[model samples]
Target: MKKQLHLLRQLVQQAVTHSDNTTSIVTDSFAVNQAGDLLMIKDVMIDYLQNLSFSKKPEVFIKRKILHTQRECITLLDMLPRTKMATPDQVALADQMRKCLDELLRHLHQHNCYFSCEVNAPYIEIQRITDKTFQKMTVMKAALKRKKIYSELLNIICAAFDRFHLSQQHTYQHLQYMSALQLSILKLCEKASDLDFDYQLIEHLTYWCFNECHFVDYCKSLIKKALKPHYGTKQCYEQLCHFEKRLTVQQEKANLRYSVQRNSVKYQLMVFVQAELECIEKKQQYHSGGKGVTLKHTAQIGSYRVQTSFSVAALAYFMKLLCESGIIQAEPRSQLLAFIAHHFQTPRIGEQELSASSLATKYKQVTPRTAHAMKAKLKELCQRIDDDFGSGD
Candidate 1:
């Protein structure tokens, strides 16, 4: 028992050390790489939970370790950036960590139940300990509830808006969309902060908005229509009315489906984890090997498919330029590369077909000499485009 307690203490210390290291790294840098930091914390917490699970130690000892781990996990959760600014990968990782912490608490509760039944102490003494433990657990659970609500709401909003794309030229429309989204989110947050907020209502609304209505596609179409030349206010209002009618029809259909499947264990589980599963699928696609389609083929850009071919390094450089310009926003270089590789075909460099993963790896090894030439080429392209635009006008 002594050895087990000692080992558990060491695991907790290790996790705490990792959490501190992650915090320090974020604090020291403005351009903190949250995905990597969050991943490190998640791995450490999982390791702690695994070690705690395998122990045959006394419930009292296990409870201590669980509480310590839970507290540390909450600290790590608090350290995460606000959901509005956090990348999708970071949000997913934080959600995973939250699940791990919940599992740990569940384990702790099981231990408490066993402890109450098995301990030979006076009945009142056991009752006091159990009640105190429950109280602490309740406090920890409350600390997590607000964060969970924010994360869930953000996830639903993001999913609904993911397909709504606009070019940089449409600055007015872009600002309006962003302002509306921010305002809606702010209101949702205020409501969620209230003590009497109906969390179940949020859950049901998320399901209805995300699954029942063609929400993403709907947003995309709405934006497209609103952006068309000479699209007046009357047309915009009529379009919204049509959308509402369609939404009502879809909601009715959704109600029938929900009534049928809401009680099913498997259906409920699927609905609960749908977002996580989609995130996993996206990651898998990002990391998967190429489809053997070379860059000689056309790639889709907006409504048009244009044929283009560029070497891997040239393409990476172009993507970097796009990020540097305010034309598009992407983070952490790897995501940008993956986006390019996913849309464009695999480019062959020196008799080797460079897949998405390989493309990212090769992009890093690009010498400064090669980068200079790519920069010059990009500048030349920009000049040509400018000349053509001037002539056209």
Candidate 2:
């Protein structure tokens, strides 16, 4: 046994040296460089011999197998991209390699130590022993048909796990078990399916392998934002700010354009009203200057309401315009004063029926000339408001 241990140490020391020296491990025909490296690597595999202990030798090989198998798997996966789109032959070759690995793993596990796998749900840990519980759970998932026999398999596997497991605090954790061996085995089966193997093996093997490895966390910490594809590139955030500024500038330009267009339309309407007013003035002068004879007329119909509605409706909107056009003067109380002068003077603008109380009292405060001046001003202001505003700004 001492001789075998010494031989194992020598093999490990040599293989580590060779791995350090070699640049590549494969050739066109087969592996020509790792031949010497492989021999040294194989010599260190102590679990392959039949006389090895279930207690001691299995643990040593477990550590070495973990390291060696990892290196070999990486080497093969790397070679895949170099091979032109995978052929059936290439897929077969990859499967053959993995199967060889599985056989080796089973052989090494033959002498592994045991612990009590017998227990109920919410598994009770026995002596902090083997990962038999995890393994059993993983395997039971794959074997739905023979659930009754699974309990016995669980106990046997647990006994082996107890002997192999090391303390969590121990510096050497080579035999330390994983928490989710089932998940790792599931992932492994997925990998095998990619190599064109039958899927049936994965479902069953995953159950058994669940007793072996741990499930690693594979989630990302951040949630990705859903943005335009351009946002994914560098410098896009700064460009987005610039685009926002340009949109604001365009909106301001549109508002200014609308205001200018509105003012031009008002100027045209005012010109038409002025021309019509000029024609009315010329016609009125012609009629008044020529009339010397009295003309017979009929009695007016509904004459009582004439001045009230006329003065307020026609003059209310136009009075303010006339005031602003220099046709009249603007002053406080000018609108009420204008109504008094016009109604009292010409066309007897309104009926005498309205108690002159409100108009008379207001007119008493101002002289006749002041009253006439204010009346003209009110009319001009009314005209200006009509031309400039829909409601007046």
Tell me, by lDDT, which candidate is best: 1
Extract clashing residue pairs from model 1. Answer: none
User: What lDDT does each candidate get?
Assistant: 0.42, 0.35
Q: Write the per-residue lDDT of candidate 2 for residues 132-205, one digit (tens) a residue.
A: 54555545445422322234334543444454454332111122223333344345544532211222232232
Off by over 4 Å in 2: 1-85, 114-393
Question: Model 1: per-residue lDDT, tens digit, 1-393?
Answer: 234334333333433444445542212132234323434544555565566667788767766766555444334433332222233443354444444434443454454332121212222222333344334443433443554544444454444433322221222222233334334444455554332133333433434433324333333443344335325433443434443343344322132221221332223333433443344345545656523222122334422322347667666666655666867554334545654555564334433334666656555566686688787887888889988786454
Candidate RMSDs in order: 23.9, 37.1
TM-score, model 1 to reference: 0.25
**Model 1 accuracy (lDDT, Cα):** 0.42
For each of the candidates, give the backbone clash count: 0, 36
Cα deviation at 138, candidate 2, in Å, is 17
Candidate 2 yields a Cα-based lDDT of 0.35
